[model samples]
Target: MSNSSPTAARLSTLDRGLPVWIGLAMILGLGIGRLMPGLGDVLESFTIGGISVPIAAGLLLMMYPVLAKVRYDRLDTVTRDRKLLIASLALNWLVGPAFMFALAWLFLPDHPEFRTGLIIIGLARCIAMVVIWNDLALGDREATAVLVALNSLFQVVAFAGLGWFYLDLLPTWLGLSATGLDVSPAAIALNVLVFLGVPLAAGYLTRRVGERRRGRDWYENRFLPRIGPFALYGLLFTVVILTALQGEAITSQPLDVARIAIPLLAYFSLMWAGSFVLGHALGLNYPRTTALAFTAAGNNFELAIAVSIATFGVSSGQALAGVVGPLIEVPVLVGLVYVSLWARRFFTDSSTATSVAVPVTSKDSS
Candidate 1:
């Protein structure tokens, strides 16, 4: 008989077949978009203060359940782990943008609009969706939450300045023709407040109220289980809507999409692998290491898309570059989730073993 406990083997069918579900969702979305070309336009018309309402809802729904599962009270530990915090900041703010700028120029030097879009993508560090990736990889939840919140704060303050630097200053310095990106701090702040603020508040309040009323056991064991599956549902929903919206752009411009995708694939792979190695070298546990890797690898494609549309018209090549970001990111990052799980064996630490061996709730994830 297998040594696996009944509980360990009790993964929900959805959990077991996550890749299939995600693949089907993508196919379904592409089909919907292809069959109904007007659907994307109709969805685009519904917005709240320059933010897409449906996308915002799906993101919020995707995030809240994962955030609620975070042990907010334990965030102090993550904060105090200066190794993890400092590494995350350096990787996200410093190395990440610079690397993407290099890749954009190196890969798409002939395509100015696409290069600019990719640079913008790099500047907009991840403040959303990374939570889902982290949780799925069994990353440290408290660390992911704290790191994501930190990124949100930095995104609001640094995004515009960084945009100017990467788009204009650095190019001019290198004697290349500079592209000026006039992005507003307020718009980025609003995007952050809406996409990150709403779900963060809801999740915090959920844990606070649930634990206060029902105790931690009931909160985690009963309440979270009921809500845990919603995170994936929300993820699937967001994927469908987003893919549908970008279906036309994606299908029509296969060559351009391929060009954009090459750099993104490189960026994601390099950043994640580099961060994971750094985390291991720094002696971080597997969970924290995974958290660092995912946060560093992910990008705020939403902000990139919005800024591209606002700066260059919606039909511009820049917008298409922005549109192609998630098309590459979703599948690539999902693959990295499995890579992370497999790499856990190399960690060879007690915590890694325990996390892997434990029978956790749906919320505990991969």
Candidate 2:
């Protein structure tokens, strides 16, 4: 039940083309902001209950297509691949966030806003791109699909609580000044509901309704193919809006953007290694191991950027940090894909050894 075949084609398109589009988005956004500052201001002023309505809408659109592709029915695999599930959860929630916190502190001690942004990035796990990464690496695509469903559900429940703990309570406990926004859990949860919950329900319903009307094959192949590009379009549109709003800040302190990127680069490298090592230690095969590694390493920048702008305002350094994330992440992950292909050879050799070492039975000798 892996949607790998369809996902593969779409991912190939995205892999080849998305970075160029994203770079153009940034440039155009910056141009718009510089050339038409009044327009950016007008858009930023359109908020609903303190959240930027345009960005929120873009976030929902970005998430919906990806979420709709998730095969919730395949979630039964959790009972079968329990170890993979447990390891993924632990790495994503526990180890990954903690690692990011340390790196942000170490690298950006004087830049609290940047540090806060990095922490937010760390807290939001990748729900969309992991499937692409897993498929490219020849990982267990079905397992990746299952984890994606679980991650989408988990983010709704845990993102707010964990954000409060890491960005607020934990900082206070350590006598460090908490630089995150002073929003309550209710506010955070509301944002999650608006951004994640609505799209998730819509996606699930879309899949169900489409299948009932058009049949499963048509739904998976035809309906999904038509809708899949929406997510990327939404992403590019959001990037343009974000950079337009933050163009002044980004232009004024260009080096700050590079400074913000350092911790992110370190976080990606460290988490990938940690997950890869842990997966092998747990005796998972290459496919499952790569799935776990990519899932752990990928961060949901769409959610992070939306929440940052909502919580801290579009012009804030925190929002700028969120914008810088995908700019760095897309290229880095593309390179990791090649690294994973090379690493596959080790797993192949391991499998060969196991087959050759099998004990012979007396019947074989006779």
Candidate 3:
């Protein structure tokens, strides 16, 4: 489990063996997907509020643990530290997504599917993953919580405009689009609401109720630890289903994965480098700088996958591009956490020294 024991689990996931877990998640997903491709669609999902979305039944089932430990009320603390909030938001949304948009087009001109994947994945920023990553990075708890809340709210408002403007039409501007595409704001919203909204609400509700019936400690100590692994395992399972959903496509165009990944890799490096330089110029702390850098750099592959599936069919090269992203992102982000730690040395600040690796749990998730 890579030092994943509950009582003393690293606040972030960088304790020792997270790369192995991320690798396992990817391998297990691909393996199961390869063995039972049809199994991915075995579960029939239902629509809520007139939306046809993947029930994310497995992912929903996984949320109980991830949400159990997060104390939602602590969200107020995020407002107290405005400096970190401003830095993280600026870097994550503006700089990061822009870099991804440019690179996705530049590196993937011939491949529309992969380009859409890069665009969708890039436009979407952190809501859930950052909570875990921030914890993993030992970032400022209040500040990170605030950013999560802020980013989610921001995406809700900005998703349609930026996603469509940047991903589809923007490509046309660059003389890159072979076909004129219509971006469905409804589909994007549906994906966000179902994949992200439901899991988060379920997590929060379960925690709130458990805290009432037994005790916060019982919920935190007993229930959450058990459920935490489920969320991750479910996440891996969903990835498998997602991969299998695109199995034939990925197999058909093996090089497409690398092609899509190139821009993602470049965007990731640029965002990280940009944030670190920005933080240094602005004289932020290590923890804060890492938070800024990673918040911009890492992606929300789950929602990205949902959007790809809805917008471009599950097996479309675009969706395949989205799937390939996390395969690169997980290990790379974990590796970056360590690299950020090393990079912290260059910052010459005490707080930067603290925010180096990814934490396993998000104690402040609201």
**Arranged by TM-score, best first:** 1, 3, 2
lDDT of 3 at 156: 70
Which structure among the candidates has the greatest lDDT? 1
Give the residue spans of candidate 2 off by over 4 A.
1-15, 49-51, 127-175, 178-181, 285-291, 306-312, 337-366
Order the candidates by lDDT, highest first. 1, 2, 3
lDDT by residue (303-334, candidate 1, tens digit) is: 88889888997678888788788778888888
lDDT of 2 by residue, 192-272 (tens): 567657877897899799888999778666676566666667767777877787676677778998899888888887788
Error of 1 at 268 (Å): 0.6
Give the total clashing residue pairs for model 1. Answer: 0
Give candidate 3 regions above 4 Å deviation: 1-15, 40-67, 71-73, 178-190, 195-228, 341-366
The stretch of ten residues in a row with the least summed lDDT in candidate 2 is: 356-365
Candidate 3 overall lDDT versus native:
0.63
Between 1 and 2, whose lDDT is larger?
1
* Strongest candidate by TM-score: 1
